[model samples]
Target chain A: MTSGLDVRGITHRYGKKTALNDIGFSLDKGLFCALLGPNGAGKSTLFSILTRLFVPDAGEVMVDGHSLAREPGKALARIGVVFQQPTLDLDLTVRRNLKYFAALHGLAGKDADRRIETSLEQVNMAERAAEKVRALNGGHRRRMEIARALLHGPAVLLLDEPTVGLDAETRSSITGHVHNLASEQGLTVLWATHLVDEVRGSDHLVVLHRGKIHANGNAAEIAGDVSLQTRFLEMTGGGK
Target chain B: MKAALICLVAIVHREALRFVSQRGRFLAAIVRPLVWLIVFAAGFRAALGLSIQPPYQTYITYEIYIVPGLCGMIQLFSGMQSSLSLVYDREMGSMRLLLTSPIPRWWLLFCKLFASTAISIFQVYTFLAIAALTGIGFSPAGYLAILPALIVNGLMLGALGLLLSSTIRQLENFAGVMNFVIFPMFFLSTALYPLWKMAEASTILRDICAFNPFSHGVELIRFALYGQVDWMALLWVLLAFAIFLSGSLWGYDPSRSMVRRKA
Candidate 1:
């Protein structure tokens, strides 16, 4: 089967500064990958380009054979995005927020209702559908956004720093849940973060530093004979 | 097309509902204009000394002449209020949700202008009704006649807000845009006083008011309130609307990657 995401020879710049250079990667179906990077590593820039929030200066992004520039709507329909910041309308109810997303993805009527309920059930937020987003804790709010992202049944999920401000237990639980979704549901995942603990041995890891990919390999293999943290710092040129 | 329309409605509905939920906003919309109408206009009635414009057949009080200007004020402030909230929405991240939708960016920004115009028209009618209750009245035919004119002016001001929202960068800088936009647009326009009145003050000030698009907005309202169409002023408002709307679309282009840095 074809890969879920194909990014080739991607280069992006901001004025005189290069945010991403010669970045290329691909993910097959059902793979969970972490975009591990340090600050100023161009992770957000890549996400902006990938999500169609910004256009890259050069290169291409293909999702399930749909090119972003040629057919952005169709390509976007196949992918889901969760921004690092919470984007929910605090004044709106959780279900209302999810329904708003459903409409954006072109799901309506009975099909939309079913998907909304199912997606909320998956993220453990079904019961709080009536509550406004302001009432939910940070972890639950993030989970709500995750459920909203999945309402369209996207083939690939792109989460940018999903666990930025959560407690340890909640963070791990959310990570485990998304990992399970990728493994069991044949969902491809690209999770961006600065945290090292979120990466696992079996998962694919792309070490991004200063807008360039330093290393890309299986986590256990790349960090072999050393702590993943140490290997990461050393690769990014952050060694003491 | 269906998906795009739905996305537009969802974003527009979110704003409309927010306006409905804020009781203070509704009252503030009415009261702010009423204060100028009752307190300020009453005091300036004699000193302003208006001639009979097309809308005024004979010697008219400053309160009566300023009604169209006050209506223009309602649209102007509502436009700026919409702009202020756009800034707030960007800071809070909700604007990002609207921006990242896969539809063409111009369509989305236009949707915002259209929505803001609807809300502004609603407020103008309400202020008109309250004005009538207080013995400040318009010709009923004049009232019906001004509806389309109000919409045109509303879109012009809202497009301006959307444009300013794109370039202002941060909420901190929003005040600067307001100062540069709001004060000049109001003081230089016929909103508080007429162009002829400004001519008495200074020829430079009169020329500035004569050229202001907002002066045309007030003229459109004034003529409409007298049950006559001001096609010349209508053309100016439409032209301003097109320019501001186009500028906003260009400013927020994804190719610029403006939001990534602005946010």
Candidate 2:
């Protein structure tokens, strides 16, 4: 199947220290894929390169058949990013943050308004749209970010360590909501995290460690017999 | 096109509200120069003599001499302040949102420049109004003439700040800006003292002062205060604006990958 996000022999470094080494993976369009890695496995680095915040040292990134190098704007337009931190301007209300993002995507006017409303509704953030970001809890902020990311109707949604500080309930609900979006709306997702349970058996999973891909396949297939925790521990060489 | 403008307005409006919200910044913008104009200049006026220049039809008080310099100071600080905000915005991820937009990088940077210039102009006028209140007033026609100079000056200073923001990489770098950039530029120029006085002190310092972009910037404002033109000053200020703006754009290009590793 054609992939939504493709990486071929991607390598990145920070000075003498290597971060990602010949990493190769592809996520099919409309797939709920998990980029699972240990701490310092270069997940965030990968995310930065993907978001065009940092250019990769070596690699090719294609989003929906568009080459990132050749047409960065188009590639950027095709993907939505939800960074690990709560990036909303605390002084701005949820609606204002959403509106700012809409403008980024060249979306405005009545169409932007409709899309903003629709995206907020999807994350159930419409009711709190007028509330300043500082007033919202962690889960609510993440929801707001999700709503903002969706405003542009991107084909690929990239979440970097998205559920870092939320309760298990909220985490699962957010994961489930993202999963549903992938299936129902054909939104390809590259959900990067260290959290084991966030990935389901059906979801595509890539295990990264020491700046290398350890394995790539269905989560259940790799985690078979042993728990995901055990497999992940063995891969990172950090488990006692 | 319309959307960008709306975003620009919202951003600029937010900055204005932020200025209103933080009363200290306003106080600082006006008070520093006000102190210089009234107390310091009154003391200096008797000692140092200034001949009539192009803008000044006759000899004026030292209070009036540095009005444009103070205006330049306002532009300089507002520009640096905008850079500080850019760093904060990067940390907060708002810059990411703007950069990731489908718009060209230059347009986004220009939008930021426009927003900052607008804020700087507001600060300039506020400073002028305060100056007028202290009997350091300009003619109403002069005030009208100054608007364009304020914009050009604000833009050049803002561009310098943008260039610094792109190059500095972190908030700690601001200390370096103050010591290495702001202080040197302010002190080295004919802001507090006349260039002829610097010539009296030392020709090398005086020659350097004569060539300072800030010297040109101040001249641009000084002439505007008298409702006249300084084409040389205008050319130098515009040249500095072009250079700094180009440097900022070069530093911020995504392909450079500074944001990736730095952040």
For each candidate, what is the lDDT?
0.86, 0.85
CAPRI tier of model 2: medium
- Model 2 misplacement above 4 A: B2-7
lDDT of 1: 0.86
Model 2 over residues A1-240: C-alpha lDDT tens digits?
Answer: 668999988898888899999999988889999999877789988888888776788998999888888898788889898989778878878887787778766676799889988998999877898988889999999988988888888999999999999999999999999999999999999999988889898999999887899999999999989998888888888643
Per-prediction RMSD in angstroms?
1.6, 1.8
Note the B-chain TM-score for every model. Answer: 0.95, 0.95
Winning model by TM-score: 1
TM-score of each: 0.96, 0.96
Superposition error at A236 for model 2 (Å): 1.5
Off by over 4 Å in 1: B260-263
